[model samples]
Target chain A: MTQEKPTVVLLTADGVPEPADLAEVRDLTDVRVCTAGTLADTLPGAEILLVWDIFSGALSDAWHAADSLRWIHVAAAGVDALLFDELRESDVLVTNARGVFDGPIAEYVLACVLAHDKRLHETEAFQRAGQWRHRETIRVAGRRALVVGTGGIGRATARLLRAVGMDVRGAGRRERDDDEDFGHVVDSADLAAHLREVDHLVMVAPLTEATRGMLGAPELAALPDGAHVINVGRGELVDQDALTAELATGRLSAHLDVVVVEPLPVGDPLWTLEGAHISPHMSGDVEGWRDTLSAQFLTHLRTWLGGDEPAPAVDKGRGYVSG
Target chain B: MTQEKPTVVLLTADGVPEPADLAEVRDLTDVRVCTAGTLADTLPGAEILLVWDIFSGALSDAWHAADSLRWIHVAAAGVDALLFDELRESDVLVTNARGVFDGPIAEYVLACVLAHDKRLHETEAFQRAGQWRHRETIRVAGRRALVVGTGGIGRATARLLRAVGMDVRGAGRRERDDDEDFGHVVDSADLAAHLREVDHLVMVAPLTEATRGMLGAPELAALPDGAHVINVGRGELVDQDALTAELATGRLSAHLDVVVVEPLPVGDPLWTLEGAHISPHMSGDVEGWRDTLSAQFLTHLRTWLGGDEPAPAVDKGRGYVSG
Candidate 1:
């Protein structure tokens, strides 16, 4: 008996959008690509679902009814969305887009931090206006940085920041065995404590019930005055209202690539915060970006076809667990 | 017999407009703080001559006659002005504040690359006017960078660029034994070869007779079209006229900390280069910057006084050497 080409559904509003890359994967022709953004719409027909942009909701009802939906490939680095109580009981396989944007996201964080500290905007304006304003700039070397979340993005960011002579620290849910080598690695509980002392705070933590609103009013308060922030993490990890108020007072300056109300709404107060720079949620997306995402999907698909379990068989309880 | 307290001179027209830090250094109660508008008037009565704003031609005569002048410390990073033939032969000790700016300068290079590629100006304006624009940004990772003059400043820039996954190549006057471990290492002779292939060019070399007008018509033409330049190096290292012409046509964008004419003469056409950014030469001067310069001098002074050679001793022929 021969095995059949697995039925696959490319869910979410945007999934790589590269026809050339996906052409080879058409062996599974019943491939349904609905820009159905919500889990409710995407989970019904998917024997294997490919989710890119995740919303914080459960698709338990759809998963329960679908007899064929056994696998889920998250198109993001974090998998907090599908790790609900409903999916924990099922034998559904889960995978994530791990190494795709590590370099690009790390590059973005560095660009923003350097731009802010060196006062590039002012320097640029001076050039445009033909003025000679020689203001001193803050140096990144010998400074301290605290990166929340220790997944691929956080690790890449830490490495980049450290190479520039920044004292970099990484924090995760639990301490890693080789934590000492990556600077001051801290457990989740110590995030607030670390915030107070860091020169720059970079948030890359995934959004989960436990991690949501992690950098709230109290966390913002703990940070030292003038602490710079670069958030490439999910918007929910930081409280938008709290961040706006904090930035308004000039106590802190932030380069936020993620926001609670993305598209920033119209006339959103976040747009008015002088210290807060909204990047339309684009720190990870770069040229040749779609090609990289599609490549990750192929690797996982090939493994499943070879009768080998995916290396990152998503632990439904922990969402996309990094095993 | 006890040694005399080291004589020190503060050699700028108007800085801090006060001599507070100079008071901290030993001996030389007769501090010659020359506020000479013209270099021709710099006095002849000093044991140590510090040149901050004064020119090389004006001091060339004085340095030849001042037998007691044992050392000349350049307040700036590049010591090309102080590295004349007469001074080189006189056995006068020379030193510069090299490491003081490794981080800030490296930060500047990274900022300009991102600014041009990410379209930061348009983005900032849009965000300020409460408009959200989703313009695509060029990814900095996986690009090639050639950092000329592998001293503290160039090395620092390389480390930062490499952190973000750029293929960082360093060019020193000569190759060292350990050059292989640090990306692609080339000698200054191979600069033209490196420039042709590089996407980003960072010049951190000190001004020398050989290096002056180094990046002239031949060099600029060699660079791939649209290649970006960041010059924290001396202005003469890049031909101002050639660079201005190149920038006017919009093929090149330059971030200049030092220009051929410092404070850039009011009527100079270099001012009009739309792509050229003038920062009033502040890449090395940060707030609390005096302390850093003072501290480095004192640390070296400790070693100089203790019968050990300074770690970053000036190469009399080559100006400031890498530490």
Candidate 2:
């Protein structure tokens, strides 16, 4: 007696996923594609939900319609926005795209650090005005970096920074002395104390209740003058108001890929803030990323269909894939 | 018998070096600092010359006044502009600030490559316009880079690029299968044939008759479309006209720290070229770099005063310090 195929819902941010992207898994499941507005209507009988829209919060709004949902896969490294109390209380399994973003985001963090030290933006401004002004740049090899996450993404960042000769440390739930990537893993509870010595404060922590607004007013003030803040994780991981206020004083510079409110509200001061490098939440979405992400989901889907659990199942209670 | 201290002419581009910067060597020598207009007047009776102004070509014009010159030390890695046929034939020994620039310039090269791959300049433009456009960036890791010139700076660049996971190759006077920093070293004589496969073509070759204009029309035409050209080396190493023509077509992008004309003549086409990133040759001139450069010169000066040869002397005939 064979079991009936599960109905799969592909929730997207805009439009629908390309047929070519889902080709390999098309015949194995009953697929239903929908945007946020249609998600509730399409979720009734679906047992599997593929969150293709990384930034969507529609899952929680349409949770009542998820009558038969047994599993959900986020095509992104962070599930901060999608996590709701009800979903965490449910028996449904959750998994995420973790390994795919590690290297790309690590490279982006390094890029932000190098861009600040080398004054590339100022150089670009000079280029625009046809100016030939020469200025001394800062050396990056010996600078200190504090990566505020100890997960896969943060570990990747620490290793890359160390490889480039930076003095790197990690901040996680607890402290460790002999971590391979970060020589000293500082406890997140003591993050403020460590900021005074950090040259680059990189934020890659998932946005959980315990981690929300981790770098607040006190942490911002703790960083050394002229320290660079790079956030490739969720924007809520930092206190945006405090960050903008500090940036206004020119005491620190920031490279924000994710902001508390993305699309960042056109009227936001950070859009024109001096020393604030703003990019639209795309640190890890490199070319052909969607294809890679879909392929990863397909592999996990295959495992689930074959009566095996996915290797990297997300810890729903913690809101991330815990080691 | 006690010997008289040597008279030293410090050729400067604009103002004199700070007295504090020269305090260590001041009591050991007769120091005469002068700009280009005053170089010839200061050259007479000076047994040693220190080229403090990296971009000055005053030495060639004042060579006839070097009545007793025994040694010349350049406060930079390149000796291209300072090298003249008469000086090469003279009995004077030439030494350069080699090791000091290797690491800094290598960091700058990595910065440029990352800047290009990550679309940093474009991101800055979007921020200025209050635009939050999401675009997919290219990955730097696994990308191929061909570093021209196998000198100290080029070798350091190869190592750093490799450290960041790039597939790096070296272009030098000859080809070799095995190299520590670069797995394969390609003969620069066949540069064009190697261009198609390179994602980034970095020119760090010291300027010499053999290498001058090496990346001319044929070489530029051979590179894969969308390839980035970065020149931290002397501008003459590339044919600026050919480079400009290619840049105008938008088939390639460039980060030029050096151009054929210093200050790049106000109305040069490259100043407004869309894909061109022009910086006033400051790649290796990081903060505190001047102090470091001067300190290095003093150490070499002390070695010479003690009757031992200054180590890492430049091969005046080759226009660089050959291994």
Best by lDDT: 2
State how far residue A210 of model 1 sits from its true place (Å): 1.1
lDDT of 2 by residue, A33-126 (tens): 8989999999999999998888789988999999999999998899987899999999999999989999999999999999999999988888
Each model's interface RMSD (Å)?
2.4, 0.8
> Of the candidates shown, which would achieve the greatest TM-score relative to the real structure?
2
| Candidate 2 chain B lowest-lDDT run of ten | B14-23
lDDT at residue B193 of model 2 (Cα atoms):
89
What is residue A133's positional error in candidate 1, in angstroms? 2.0
For model 2, the stretches where C-alpha displacement exceeds 4 angstroms are A19-21, B19-21
- Inter-residue clash pairs, candidate 1: A94-A314
Chain B superposition TM-score per model: 0.85, 0.96
